[model samples]
Target: MFMFKNLKSDLPASIVVFFVALPLCLGIALASGAPLFSGLIAGIIGGIIVGGLSGSRVGVSGPAAGLAAIVLTAIGSLGGYENFLVAVVLGGIIQLVFGFLKAGIIGYYFPSSVIKGMLTGIGIIIILKQIPHFFGYDAEPEGADSFIEASGENTFSAIFNIFDNIAVGPTVVGLISLGILLLWSNVLVKKGKFFEVIQGPLVAVAVGIIFYVVTQTNDALAISPAHLVSVPVPDSFDSFLGQFSFPNFSAITNPAIWVTAFTIALVASLETLLCVEATDKLDPEKSVTPTNRELLAQGTGNIISGLIGGLPITQVIVRSSANIQSNAKTKMSAILHGFLLLISVILIPTLLNKIPLSVLAAILLIVGYKLAKPALFAKMYKLGWKQSIPFFVTVAGIVFTDLLVGIGLGLAVGIVVILLKSYQNSHFLHIEDNSNGKHKIKMSLAEEVTFFNKGAILKELDSLPRDTYLEFDVTKTRYLDYDIIEILEDFAFKAKERNIDIKLISKRGIVENPDSFIEFFKLRPKSKISLS
Candidate 1:
C-alpha cells in the first residue's frame, strides 16, 4: 500500500538504487563464498518482502557486506552451505522472538560516538576494499571488509599489488565511469530534471557495458570475465527455479546449526538496528522508524529468504543512503528495486553480466567518500577528546580488524570513558581558609554517590590537617552506596583522634558530638556528619 503512494519519486529512485544494489548483492555473495544468486535472492526479498513489512520509509534491506565475513566462516564451520541455511532459518526465528520480546531497546544503548565511528569505519573499509577493483585487480573478492585479504595480502599490500596487475580495459572503464559519475553528481544533475532522472551510476554502468562490447576485438582493452558482473544465466524458467537452494531440514536438529543460527540472528539484528538508526538520521524528512516492527520485518524476510535460498539479510546503510540521495520518497523505491533485481536476473542476465566490475567499483568509491568524508573527521575532532577518542578508535578498529571486533573494541573504550566521567563527577569537595590556623572543608555528596567516589573522598579526608573543621553534606543525597557510608563512618573516628570538632547534619536533625558515625547514620538514614 505504501509502495504505490509515491510512484513518481520512488520509480526513479528505485532505478538508481537498483544500479547501486546489483553489484553489491553479487559482491557480498562472492565475498561470503556463496553462490552469487543467494545475495540477489536476499536483495529481492529485502526489497519486496521486508520492504512491504517494515515501518521504515527509506531503509533498504539486503545481504550486507558487514555479514560477509560471518557468513564465510559460518558456511565452513557448518560443514556446508545447506547446513548454514538451516542456521539462517533458525536465526530468523530467533529474531522473530527477539522482536516479540521487545529486544530492540538494546539498539538505543549504543553510544553516538561508536555509531559515527562505525559509519566512518565502514566508509574507510569500502574505500580500501574497492581500490583494487577500481584498478582492475580482481584477486580479492568484492565486498571483503577486513584488513587482511583471503589471498594473504593486507589492505595496504592489496592496494600496492593493484599497481602490478592493472588491466587496461577495466582501468580505462573505471576512470571514465568515475569521471562520468562525478560530473553527473556535481553538474548535470543540477541543470535539469532529465539529467537528475538519468542517475550517474546507471550511466556509468551503461557506459561500462558498451565499453566491454567495443573492446571485445581489442586484446589491449579487453576486460576479463573475472572482472565483470557475473550473475548466472539460466537457459529456461525451470533452470532459473533450480538456482534456488532449499535448506536441509535434517540439519535443523544439529546443535551447530542452532549455534550458527543464534550467531546470525544476533549479528544480523544488531547490524539491522544500527543501520536503522543511521538511516533515520540521514533521512531529510526526519521520520522515526519503529524499531520493533523493523526487527519483525527483518526476521520474516530472513526466514523466507533462507527457506527459498538466500544469504542473511540486514538493513544496509549503503543502499539506503543511495536511495535517499536519489530522492526516493517512500518504501516503494525499495520494493521496486527488489522487483527490478528479480526481473533483470530472469530476463536480461546476459546484459547485466556485461557490465564491468570496475564501473561498480567507481560507484562504491563515491559512496565510500560520502560516508567517510574528511569533514566528518574534523567535526568529530572538534567535539573534543571524550567523543573523538571513541570515534577514532571505532574507525581504526573496524578498518584494521573485523566489524564486530572493531565495535567491541570501541565499546570497551567508550565504557571506560563513561566510568572515568562518572568517577570524576561523583562528588564535590571544597576547602577554605578560616582565621586562627584552622581550615574549613565542605564535601557535598552527589545525588547518587557510588563506590567510585570512595577513593577521592578517602584521599581528601586523609589530607586534612589537625584541628580542622570538616563539613559533610548529604541533604540532597538520595541513594548512597554502603562503601561510601563506611568511608564517612571511618573518617569520623580519625577526625576525633586529630582533635577536630564534629558537626553532624541530617534530614532528621543535626547530631553534634555523635558517639558513633555508623550508628548515627543508621539512626537517621538521610543524613551526613561533619567533624571539626
Candidate 2:
C-alpha cells in the first residue's frame, strides 16, 4: 500500500523519465552498432527487472552510454552481435558472482570528492554533447559521452560544426521545448497539480509533435526524419518479435568472448556501484542502497537482456538524476517507465517516433545544468585542496576524456592527498621542560602509524641534538608498522652514544634508560643485527 501510495507522484515522474530514456535507448544502440531494437529491449529489461530486484530507491538501470564503446568493439571482435550476446550474459553472471562475494564494498572506497566530481563532470558533458543536437545537427549519436566522438568530430569541433549544418526546424522546436520546460518548472508546475501531473517534458514533446505535423510541407522549416526519435517500426507483431537475437552458445569457448565478458562485468559493476552511491547521495531521504543486492539485480537484468538481444546494462546517473529531479518517491517510478518503454514500442511506435530528438535534447540540457551548477565548484573549493584538487581534476577529465577515465584521474589525486595527510599525522611533538642545558622533547605517536609514517618518524629521531633527553611515547598507538618500530629501536641504541637519555613509555609501562624499543613494543622480531 505504501509503495502504491506514491503512485500519484511516481506516475508523473515516470512519464518524464520515459521521454528522457526513449532517444537514449535508440542512440546508444546505434552508437554500439547493434540492432536499434536491442537497445529498447535492454531499457525494458533494465527498468522492469532491475528496478524490481534492486535495493536502490531512486537509481535507474538501462543501456549505458559509457559502455557503448566496449559493446561496439566487442560485437566486432567477437565476430558478430549474436556472439557478443554471449559476453553480455557471461558479464551478468560475473556480476552475480561479485554480489555473492560481497565485492560491492569496493564502491565505497571512492572519496566523496571524486563522486561529486563525477556528477559535475557528467553534467557539463551533457550540456556540451547536447548543444549540437539542440541545434538539430544529429550526426553525433545520442548518449555519446566521449570527448572524441565515433563520428571523427570531437565535442568542441562538433559544436562548431553545428553552425554550418544546423536545421532551422529542429532548432525552433528545441527552443520552444526549452522555453516551455523553463516556464513549467519555474512557474506553471507550482500553480496547480494539473500542470505537475501532465509534466513539462510531456508537454514539450507534445508540442514538438504538433510542430512536426504543421510544418511537414514547408521545406525550410520542416523537420527532417533524421532529426526525430528513430524507433524501429516493424510492419507486424511477428516481425517485431523476430528482431530479438539470441546469443551463440557455440562461442562460449572463445577466448575473446571470455575477455569481453570479464571487461564488461568489471566496468559495469564499477559504474553501477558508483551510480548507486551517487543516487543515494541525491536521494532526499538519504537511504543507503544495498550495493550487493544492486549487483545481483544488474546481473539478472543483463542476463535477460542479452538472451533476448540487448546491449549490456548499468545504473545510469543521467536517468537516475532525472528520476530524482522529477520527485519520484519510490522505485515504482522506474518500474512504470519501463512499462511505458515496452508499451510505446508495441502500440504507439508511430507517435513516439514523431517526437523530435531536439525536444529530448532540451530536457537533458536542463538535467545537465542541475548537476553542474557553478555554485558546486565554489563549495568544493571552500573545502580546501584535499577536496578541490580531485573535484577539478575529475571535472576536467570527464570533459576531455570519458567517465571512467575522469573518475580514475580524480581517485588518483585523492589517494595522494590522503597519503600526504597521513605523513603529517604520524606523531605530535610536545616541549616539556628545557632545564639542565638538555632539551626535553616528548614525542607522542599517532593512533595508527604505518610505513607511510616511517620517513617522518626517522627524520624527527635523526634531528635530536647531543645530550638531549627524549621521551618516546607509544601508549596511545594501536598499530605500529615494523618500519616505524625499527626506526625507534635503532634510535634508542644511537641515543646512548649521543648522550641523549631515552625514556620509552608504552602500554606495558615506562622503561627508564631502555636500550632496545623492540622488547617493549613486541611488534617486530628482534633484528639479528640489533640483537648482535
Candidate 3:
C-alpha cells in the first residue's frame, strides 16, 4: 500500500498531528460533557478506522468541538450517556444509508468564497481561543469554539483577563516553544533533511517538558499541573478495559432516540462534506477527495466508536490543517497519529500528561497565521466585493458567533448574490429600430427564465410606450418556465390594448400575434418549468 511509501514525510507529520489531536480529543470531550476518555476513543477510531477507509489524502478525523453543544444537550434530554450511545449507533446506520443514496454531492454547492472564509475563520478562532492558554489562563475548557465561552467570559474578555491572570512560567515556555517552531520552519529546514524529518512540534514539546521539569522546585516559575495535558490513568488492564462503554440497545425503540440519531447523521455528514471541500482546496496537489466514500467511512467509524462508548466523529479542519502544514504525504500520517494516541495513553500516560498546554498553544498559533494572512485579505478584496463580502462576513460571523452560524451567514449572503445576478441576467432589452414614430424594441429572454425573472419581465412589458412594435425573442432560449409563459400570454392581450404590434420568434416556430404563448411553444411537462 502507499501507506509506507512516504514514511519520511508522513511519520514526522503524524507526530505533529498526534500532539495536536491529543489535547483536542480531551478538550472536545470536556466540552461535550462526556467522560474525557470518550474523546480519545473517538480520536483513535477516527484516525485508524476512518482514515483507512476515507478517500481523502490529507483530512484528519476526530471528536469535533462543533458537536459539543449537541452532545451535551442530547445527553440530558435522552436521560443519560448510555441512551445517547444508542442514538450514536443509529446515527451511524443512517449515515451508511446516506452514503448508499449518494448524498455527499451536496458539498459541491458551497461557494469558494465561503470555503476560504471557513478556513480563515477557523484559523482566527484558533489564534483567538489559544491566546488565553498561551498566557497561562485555564478557566475556559480546552475544546470550546464558541465566542461566549462556558466560563461566562467571551473570547475578547478572556484575552483582556490575561492582563491580570498571566503566569510567568507557562508564558515563558510558550514563547520559547514558539521561537523554536519559527526557527525550525524558517531557517533550519533550509539546511538539511535532518531538520525536516525531526519536526519542530516534537522539539517544542520536549523543551516545554524540560522547562516543566527544571522549574518544579521554583515556585515562581514552575508550570502547574492545571496548565498541562490531562490523560486519564487507569489502575490496570482491567480498569482500562472498563473504560469502554456499550450502547443501550433497548433504547432503539424510543422515538426521541430516532430524532437524535437523524440529527446527528445530518449534521455530522454536512460537516464532513464541508471539511472535505475545504481540505481539497488546501491540498497543494489539488487532489479531490471522494465525497460519497468519505461519508461511508465516517459512518463506519461512528458505529465502531459508539459500540465502544466514543463520541461522534467528523473530519476536523484543525488537525487536518496541521497535518498538511506538517507536510504529510498520505493517509498514513493520519492513521499513524491514531496509533500514537493509543500507545501514549496505554504505555506512557504519565509522560504524556507532563507536556505543557502553552507549548501546544504556540504550535496552533503558527497554524492559524498561515491560514489567515494579511496578504490573503488583500487578494480576496482585489477580486472585488462579490468574493470579499462572503469571505469577510464568514470570518466575522465565526469570530462573533460560532462555526455553523458563521457559515450559515456567509452561505445566506452567497445565495443572495446569486439571486441578484440571476435577476439582472433574466433578459436583454434593446431598441432594434425606431421608425414611423414607434420604437421597435426587442426583448430577448435569457437561456432559462424562472419565476425569479417574472417581476422584471412584467415591469418592462407594462412600461412599453403605446403604438410600439415589440419583438419577443426566444430563439436562443432552451428551457422556459411556465410562469414566464403565462406572463407572456397576459402581456399579449395587454399589448393589443396599448396598440402594440407583436412578433414572437423561437427555434420551435414563429407566430405573428400568437393566440396562446403556451400552445404555440408547446411547453414540456416537467422540463420547461420548476413548479412555479
Candidate 4:
C-alpha cells in the first residue's frame, strides 16, 4: 500500500540505491567473515520485506557494517557460521518481543544535536574511507565505517598508504565516474527527460565496465578483478539454490547462541532506531516514522534473513540517504532496489562484477559530500555553544572512535549542559528600596525547586543585609525538594540574628510569625504553603 505512488521518481531512485547498496551488502559480509551471499540475502530481505513492512518511506534496510565485528566474533565463538545463523534467528525473535514491549520509545530520547552530528560524522567517515578505494587502494572492504580497519591501518593511515600504491586504471575509472555523477546531478538531469530517466551512477557503472573490458590488454589501463564488484556466481540452478543456507535449528539449545541473539537484537534495534531518526530528519517532506513499527519490520526481516543463511540486517543510513538524494518518493524505491539486487546477482553476476569498485566509491563520495557539507558546520556553529558543543563532540568522537561511543560521549555532554542550565535557573532574586528606608529582598523559587538550587539559595540568603525585610516567594512553585525546605528552615534562625524580618508567602497566605520552619511546614499541608 505504501508503494507504487511515484514511479517516475521511485524507479530511477531505486536503480541508484540498488547500485549503492549492492557493494555495501557484499562488503559488509566480507568484513563480517560470512559467506558473501549471506549479505546479498540480507540486502534482498531488507529491501523487499523490511521496506514493505516499515513505516519509513525513505529508509532502506540491509546488512549493516556496524554489526560486522559482532558477526565476525560471534561466528568464531559459536564454532561455525551455521551456529551464528541460529543466533541471528533468535535475535530476530527477541527484536519482535522488544517491539511488542514498546521499547522503541528510546529512539525519541536521543538529542537532535547528537543525531545531526552522527549524520555529519558518518558522512566524513564515508569520504575518508572511500578515498583509498577511489585511488584503487582496496585493502579495506567496501562499507567499512570504523576508523580502524581490518587491514591494520586506520582511516587516515589508509589514505596516506594510497599515495604509495595507487592503481592507474581504477583511478581513471573513478575520476570519470565522479565527473559523470556530478554532471548528472548538477547539469544533465535539468537538460531533458532523457537524461533524467537515466541515473548518473547507472551510467557510471556501465561506462566503468566498458572501460575495464576495453583496457584488459593495456597493463596501465586495466583494472584488476580485485578492484571490481565480486558477487558469487553460481555455475547452475542447483548451485544457486545451494547458496541459500538454512540455520542449524538444533543449535537453538545453545546458551551462547542466546547470548549472541540478544546482542544482535539489541544492537540491530538501536542502529535501526538511530537510522530511522536520522533519515526522518533528512526527509524533505518532514515525515515522522513509526519507530515501533520499524522495529517490528526489522525483526521480521532479520528472522527471514537468518533463516535463509543471511547476515543480520538494520536500516542503513548510507543507502537511505542515497535513496533520498536520488529523489525517492516512497517505500517502492527501497523495495525495487532490493529486487534489483536479487535479479542482478542471480541473472548477471559476471556482468555485475565488471563494474569497477572505483566507480562505486565515486558515487559514495558524492553522497558523503552532500551529508557533511561545510555549510552544515557553519550552521551548527551559528546555533551557539549549547548546540554546537555536543555537535562538534559527536563528530570528533565518531571520527576518533566509533559510532556508539561517539554518541555516548555527546549524550553525556548534552546532559551536563542541561544540568548547568537547571542550576542557573533554579530561582530568581529581586531587591527594592522601600520609602521607610529598609531594603526589601524577594527570592522567588523556580516552578520545580530541586536540591541542586540549595547552594545558590543559601548564598543569596547569606548576602542579605541586616535589618532587611525578606520575602520568600513560593506561590508558583510546584514540587519543592526537602533539602531546599531544610535550608529555608535553617536560614530562619540566622535571619533573626541579623535583625531580618522574614515573611513567608505560601498557598495558605502570608505568615508573619511562623513557628520553627520544620514545624510550620509540617503542620500545613504542602498545597497550603506558598513561599512568596
Highest-lDDT candidate: 3
Cα-based RMSD of candidate 2: 2.7
| Residues 38-124 of candidate 1: C-alpha lDDT, one tens digit per residue | 999999999999999999989999998777778899899888888888888889999999999999888887888998898889888
Clashing pairs in 3: none
Q: Order the numbered candidates by lDDT, best leading.
A: 3, 2, 4, 1
TM-score of 2: 0.97
Q: Which stretches of candidate 3 lie over 4 Å from their true place?
A: 524-532
lDDT score, candidate 3? 0.90
lDDT measured at residue 259 in model 3 versus the true structure, 0 to 100: 95
What TM-score would you give candidate 1 relative to the actual structure?
Answer: 0.93
Q: Please tell me which model should have the higher lDDT, number 1 or number 2.
A: 2
Q: How do the candidates rank by TM-score, highest first?
A: 2, 3, 4, 1
Q: What is the TM-score of each candidate against the true structure?
A: 0.93, 0.97, 0.96, 0.94
Which segments of candidate 2 are over 4 A away from where they belong? 524-532
Clashes by residue pair, model 4: 472-531, 473-531, 473-532, 474-531, 474-532, 505-530, 505-532, 506-530, 507-529, 507-530
Q: How many residue pairs clash in each candidate at the backbone level?
A: 3, 0, 0, 10
| Candidate 1 residue pairs that clash | 500-532, 501-532, 502-532
lDDT tens string, model 4, 48-156? 9999999998999999888888998999999899899999988999999999999898998988999999999999999999999999999888554665366667788
Give the CA lDDT, 0 to 100, for residue 441 in model 3.
Answer: 95
